[model samples]
Target: MVQTVQSADGTTIAYEQAGSGAPLVIVGGALNNRQSAAALVPPLAGDFTVITYDRRGRGDSTDTPPYAVDREIEDLRALADAAGGPVHLYGHSSGAILCLEAAAAGVSVRKIAVYEPPYFTHHVRDEPWEVFANKVKTLADTGHGDQAVEAFMRHAGVRFDERVKQEPWWPAVVALAPTLHYDLTLEADGVVPEERFGSITAPVLALYGDASPDWAVASAAAVATSVKDGHQGVIPGHGHDVPPEALVPFLIGFFHE
Candidate 1:
């Protein structure tokens, strides 16, 4: 069933739930909404009451102007409250950063599993962020949001096949271009916020793909080291976009324990 929760700031966060077990909330990264969790839901549903949501501004969720990291954190807290209390969290890419931040803030969460959060060790953010953001802002503001999406994808090393460009879902991506800038702003040079990660006392499972970039490995490693009871693992034969199956077993094991 679809459910809605009012975040502390009054933004309405929409979510869906399925299967039956301990509550597990899945948060997707940049340019993603609830639909992005489709691939993971089936396999995970057997073991968890999976709750997938449209993080504000992405899908059915409403957004408040002047975004702030703490606001997103509050949205998560509201979701957890709706789930009947503390729940496990699973976040991919930039969404993983949000999950870690929530846990660090001592929010009511049981455990967390984050996959390849775009945390850079040295200097992964190649260009000065404002330049990149300005380019995207210009394209999105100029009524060429699709091109803006394309630009952001290219910047992220995404090589889209012609067939992918032809897909119906492509337009949805274009429509969400502005949120890409919001995400990049949240990323902020991809550096790990050491103070936050280190402050987290809840158990964390930091997942990195074998084929992921060096910076991803460093970031996950740093997170695992910081959390009091955190663990790290590598998903073999995967890149930055590790498939859901590679994550299922580890997640089931961690949350069940």
Candidate 2:
């Protein structure tokens, strides 16, 4: 069953938890909700309490007016408060960017681990954010949500053809089209803010798959080197979709240490 927590802005954030011991929150990337992190729970559940919540505006969570990344940090703060003190965070893709932001903003983070934060510093985007944002906004605002989702997916290198559209989960993914701007905003210009990262006091672990794109690998390295106390690791023989077997060990080792 889902539980609720009230963020600073009074938005009701929905979440579920498993296991026991210290709190560990898993923040998923764009188009993902609380359910999206379910695959990771089983393995890590044995070592820590796993909390997976829907980012506001998706799943059972409610959204407030004029979304800001700070509000999302407040949502994380609420989760941390509910966890009963400082909490560990593990973020993937754009979610990792949010984690870095939260930690830098002085959220009570004990430690943080991120996987491929999607910072394209090494390989810049072809078009400016305004152009892409307008296209997605227009598509989503005009009731062409499917097209909006497709545009974001294509930009993210996801295969969104007819076969994918026929899947049952496609509609849920499309429904999250409005939040694409949230992720895009987090990634503004695709440059990694090294100065902001320098402010984070928590130990940071940046991981990228060996088989992932060169830019992703470089981004992880840049993140690790930028922070005061950061480490980078490679998940060998893996790509963006890292399997639980390969990922859990690294997480356990890092979070436990």
Specify the highest-lDDT model's number.
2
| lDDT tens readout by residue for model 1, 131-250 | 987888789878988878887877777885667768988888888887886777667767777776787888999999888778778988988987888899888999988777787888
Candidate lDDT values, in order? 0.85, 0.91
RMSD of 1: 1.7
lDDT of 2 by residue, 1-257 (tens): 79999999999999999999889999999999998889899999999999999999999999997979999999999999999969999999999999999999999998899999988886867688789977887898788989999899888877767788899989888899888888888888788898988998899999999988888898899899889999999999998888889999999999999
Global lDDT of model 1: 0.85
Worst lDDT run of 10 residues, candidate 2, spans: 121-130
